[model samples]
Target: MKLLFLIVLMYMFDQHKGNRLSNNPRPFEDIKREISDYSEVAKKIINLAVYGKAQNRSYERLALFVDTIGPRLSGSKSLELAIQYMYKALKNDGLENVHLEQVKIPHWERGEESAVMVEPRNHSLAILGLGGSVATPPEGITAEVLVVTSFDELHQRAQEAQGKIVVYNQRYVNYGETVLYRGRGALEAAKVGAKAALIKSITPFSINSPHTGIQSYAVGVPKIPAACISLEDAELIARMSSWGSKVVVTLKMGAKTYPDADSFNTVAEIVGSKYPEQVVLVSGHLDSWDVGQGAMDDGGGAFISWEALSLIKDLGLRPKRTLRLVLWTGEEQGGIGAEQYYKLHKMNISNFDVVMESDEGTFMPSGLAFTGSDEARGIMKEIMKLLKPINITQLFGNGEGTDISYWMKAGVPGASLNDDITKYFWFHHSQGDTMTVQNPMEMNLCAAVWTVVSYVVADMEEKLPV
Candidate 1:
């Protein structure tokens, strides 16, 4: 009977991996039977995470991690300390193959920065200098303000922008659509000879908060100071400019870009019981903007991933394929660590089955956004069904994340946790991103889903179709 069961399992994996279901559709009952084993494991995971002793563990861990090591910006000394903190934490957790791989990353400091209205009004404007922005002169750059809502308007009034400070008050559409202004506001402003650029915080909702993010400089174009201003202040200046108000502002930023610094991608894993060479990768970047505690931006995501491995270990369950966790560095400054990881590991791309990243807020998880073939989606759907106990079982088609997109584009199956991120951008790259934005119960649910999906995918005999 045992021999027959093994033979049947091999046949099932063989048929599924070979994509035989395309020509031959099996009955739903057979599908249920095939996934029944996973359902049992999922129940155990839910119980451990939601009800057992591990409840709220991820949230507590995240709080400790972030509280101990506040914002971990790229190439900062605090970031290096944050890496050591995780290195010790993971080893203490009893995870196997714990180590770090060096990756060179950029270093930029947000020195003393401030902006104030000198003419028309003397109200101090809330500001946070964009990363990689050059410092303004010690005396500061006081210029006439040229308020424009979009790039087109800037081009339309190019003559007015010359020698003026361009304040971009672009309306909030969405993060992806609106964040472009934050990234390129300075480059565009410099084109028309603007001395500096101030962008409105890219959030639909804000309580007088100034956000900061990375800004890229074009080759051969003069670099100008770029910073994010509070929505209220930007709108104030824009409204003043609209009513024929001459709003002169003085912006001072001590920002500077140093040479590249050392960094590492912290790693830990559970070696497979069977095929140790095959890996199911899970990740969250450890680096964050030098703002608040960074609990919401990524501390929650990183700890939940750690919780996944911890839960499996506590339950004494090892998957058939290795489940590797990578805490990436330098993600905020444009995926500096993950990009190197991809270049280093792409040669063994076939060995990687799935790459999962959680850059989006770790709010109450709803389901997953996945990128893969139809057959792979079918497998993912079955796995998600096991998460029904947590009341999250819907899978979306578009799987997108900054760190994991590289693997997805290269045809490796990718998955990103789908959660209620309606307010993700509100705290993103800002001081509002702290433990107050995270819920313990929500983190528990997210950890459960992350663990269940990663475990089942690793243990399942069938390989996800590339």
Candidate 2:
């Protein structure tokens, strides 16, 4: 087999007239000569990068995906439809070994909800129940509002919060910090004897829009009604709190959790011709929030990845390593889809050479990141030479994406296509996370970067280090 592969490599090198090998009269000497033809191979890669820019397949496919799948909040009928849509699309893209990996997912439903500041100002406030938050009693809970700026302040001012709506007027900051308030603020508020809790929206900028994301209830603490108020309303409450004037708030949240449901991760693969055992994986989650058709949060991410692979297949550029794509389910609900997938296919991890993920909101392509050895970092840096035309030079030496972190932990070198995240947090986890958030030209440019880099990784002779 080794002898046959060497002979074929030599024959292809001679046929392509690579470097000095084409001029050599001796066949055996060409084998040694072709070994140093990395420059010729690099040139082909550069040409593909330029070609990718002209193909607008990614934008066309993204529009179609949004039109078909729509919003895909976890466990909703829309999410179920997304599974089917992605499965069919993968099969149509000429990917072999297409199948679903089953996963048990939680079914949290958003029901009726309403909020209003009953005193000082009698106007209804925009509100949405955070995912996993228990609903208020059918009659609802109305109490005085006791606002605090931070968790430390809440603990210090527990006297003011007694039997009142302890409104956490914490300002939104970076995702690493702001997300903590959304995830654990409710549980902390319940630790005290507050009637209920209302949180300021977890976004930096908004036009009277309430953002909702998942929150957890501690094991022994009493679970109370919690909802996010629009930034505009939150500021009003903050002002009233500063004056030491009594603030009354009425919160009616109607969210509930049903029994577990069944879902699947849609998997597709373009098989390798020479080294089929090695795999290069790329993916995005297919599920999104129920509100506003979830076009930016993930629909764009999934479609763009699919489009990149589709371009490679269309170009008839078969790789030496298998290129796999997974449209995942249940990412918004705390990485359930990724965890289930890792467990179901743990054995296959050994064969995975590299895995790339794109979960960031659609923005102009800034660059790529890596989570592997220094050798792999050097290889990625070299590969970027081919991608320089696409404006994708920013590289992180030790970075991993949320969805593919499982693979990286298991030793599969992982990378994420880093998009411009400057404004991502504004609409993330909110009703504003729609397709309208994207600029079509920017999306296409990002897809072009993915196409070139992914193709090079697939076709390269050496495996991604580490």
Candidate 3:
């Protein structure tokens, strides 16, 4: 494979050399000039990000935010304080039009929870109640365990699942496939008269740490206690049951849901010099789950977005269209804050030229996943040429972040920073999500890419075609 790839590369290079030596060489000068025009400013952005290493500031700020405010769960007082911190910080940084937009968010608390193995040997298991799950009775519920690899298996053994604790030992395929059990395992188990559901952490690898995430109960289905157990525990129960050994477990939870609480989406901007009404928006969610410090999952994303605006502002560079930064809340609860923002500002949706989000962890810059028209793609291709020095040149199509999907559906262009996501799922929504997972250089590179993209797009003469 390597030799074939080398041969193909050599052939391509020789073809390029042949074309360059031909008398009828293509007019590549014009394209080079266009790239240079954007590259001039792009160089400065990269320098600022590289030399300044803005990631250090972002990391420190995230550390402080995590230490001081910690776990910005939607509707929690900590989340509210985090919003206030950013609101004041943005204003103090001299960003224009800094303010907060109100959003009501669901408040769910995981009071106390535990799972224990009773039969086959008494042992305690690591567990975390799935967000939005109902509580077990005050004493708890104990039943024999019924393990299934998929919903199909559960259905096949529906009769045996009655009055048992359904254990989903589904193998980790990919996030999109494995997450089905986390999102609907309880509902599926309830349909078969199970007393409770225990899911293997949705991550591909684990260290006896359970990952917790939001789960939704289907309407008209019975609600039951659902939680995640360490991958080891899930496998242990699966093995025991496979040996025809009776495995019984006891589950107890004090989880509760309260009335919706008030929150806000913090907004800041650098008004455009030519067209103030037209906007280029970049954002990341400010809220996270109640587990880790929320550093890698989204703290890095949020701070890098802020750092992009800060870098441009410090350089005194103003785009032709407004550059707006929105720190969203309730994203962990399914993009509640972004949805509200869209509804409130959708009337002027046409004014938005592009929307970009960075929810994926800030590892290293690969490129961007973009969604737009062919004309817009052409424009972006030329613009991305400016990023060649930083090794970011790919332009993927038909991909956008959850928070900006609505805007893209409304005919606005959308983009998301593409990076090395190999380890992202390992730390995502788990206690492993912390500042230790981030690197200063990689985060600065991300900030540089975001700054250049937002600035150039906002300054371009033509709006992205619909």
Candidate 4:
């Protein structure tokens, strides 16, 4: 009996891998029975997500949603509007336990801003007020502009930065590396007693649009106004410097911080049947920059997760563990929403079976990057076998999304949906970001992949390793 069972098991496994049984035609009923053994709930979830992507048209749906929500900057009225819309949308999806967790966010308003090179010919530079930046006085500051491409250069020329507006023209080879300038350029410049700082927009491609992100103020350094200039303008400044001409810039901005505003992390859940305590989390941010619609940055990520969860709910396939979707706010500003969510839910980290984040733009699915225990790694390989049909066949050992980083630090298994990001940095943090950037079929494919992974994680009885 044992030998016969082993042979039968090997045959079934081959069939699961799409091998036919000796070219013998089977009845439709027999085929269905065989396929059902591979987790019917997971299959249904993938189908429903694919259907949603088709019906709504991922790009159009994302544009309509982003265009309507507008810029959802943290602590802004628009952000408040976005939160309400998201809450309603989650409830409409019929997700149980849908609610918002309060997160206090610092309010910073970007008032009127203008920059011009007064000396070495009159040249107006496109500028974006960085979040949390101190505004120049009503009179503004007009001073010589010193250009430096890196922190190392600034350190070498500390004397030149005094009483000048240091322009950090650092280029980012990758979004992760380039983003460092946006977060810390001001502090680095201020240490040299620079009157102000201007950073080159962190983008690989741009016409004249400037990118705005958050900057940190160093303790004990005199707080100074800092802003970002369009890539074109930064290049112009560099050209002037190479010519040995002093570039004086006039900057006027009215940015100011207000009292903390009430924000939220939106959550929707489909409860599990057997092990309801275990949960699989998936989501993206609901916020965008104050510039163009943040379609690619995260708006695409938000709806896909929402619609994916909705698809699972519609399929009537309850897994063994719950699937939770989170729509985080303030991801663009500094991941404040993610930080708050982590703080509030860190204690419940053990309950999370697997956490998946999709901050990368909605492009075709490449695979997934995972970080977890050795056992979880082995299970993921098995899971990959199920995903091979959908073209997600690769797995990376060293990646997780920015939002899920907190969970990973707290010992929860985390992963990121790796997309074909060859073009992601071109429009990242720019006005060029919009829904049109994504292909519908590819987005649908991505949604399908997410559904498969999420469902399998939720259905499995054992918690993913590490």
Name the top lDDT candidate: 1
Q: lDDT for each of the candidates?
A: 0.90, 0.76, 0.88, 0.80
Give me the overall lDDT of model 1.
0.90
| Model 4 worst lDDT run, 10 consecutive residues | 15-24
lDDT, candidate 3, equals: 0.88
lDDT of 3 by residue, 397-462 (tens): 765888998899888889998999999988888888887888888888888888898999888655
TM-score of each: 0.94, 0.88, 0.92, 0.89
What stretches of model 2 exceed 4 Å from their correct place? 1-54
**Per-residue lDDT for 204-251 in model 2, tens only?**
888898888788888899888778888888889889878977778788
What lDDT does candidate 3 reach at residue 104? Answer: 92
**Weakest ten-residue segment in model 3 by summed lDDT:** 17-26
Ranking by lDDT: 1, 3, 4, 2
Candidate 4 residue-wise lDDT, 1-466, digit = tens: 9999999999876533321123444544543343346555555555555553344555566777787877777788888888888788778768899999998877888899999998989978999989899999899999998999999999999998999999988876877788888888888888999988999998887788898888889778888898989889998999889999989999999998998788999998998877677789998998877777788888888877886686676666787788999988888766778898888877767678888888888898887788987656766766766665565768777657778888888888888878888888777766778766877777777777777778777775455655
Indicate the residue-level lDDT of 436 in model 4. 64
Give stretches of model 1 more than 4 Å off. 1-32
Q: Write candidate 1's Cα lDDT for 1-466 as tens digits.
A: 9999999999887644522234445654665566777788899999999999999999998988899999999989999999999999999999999999999999999899889999898989999999999999999999999999999999999999999999999989988899999999999999999999999998887789999998899999999999999999999999998899899999999988999999999999999877787889999999999999889878988988999999999999999889999999989988989999999999988778899998898998899999999878987888899988878999998887788878888989999999999889889999999999999999999999999999988887655766
Which has the better TM-score: candidate 3, or candidate 4? 3
Candidate 3: where are CA atoms >4 Å away? 1-35, 53-55
Clashing pairs in 2: 370-399
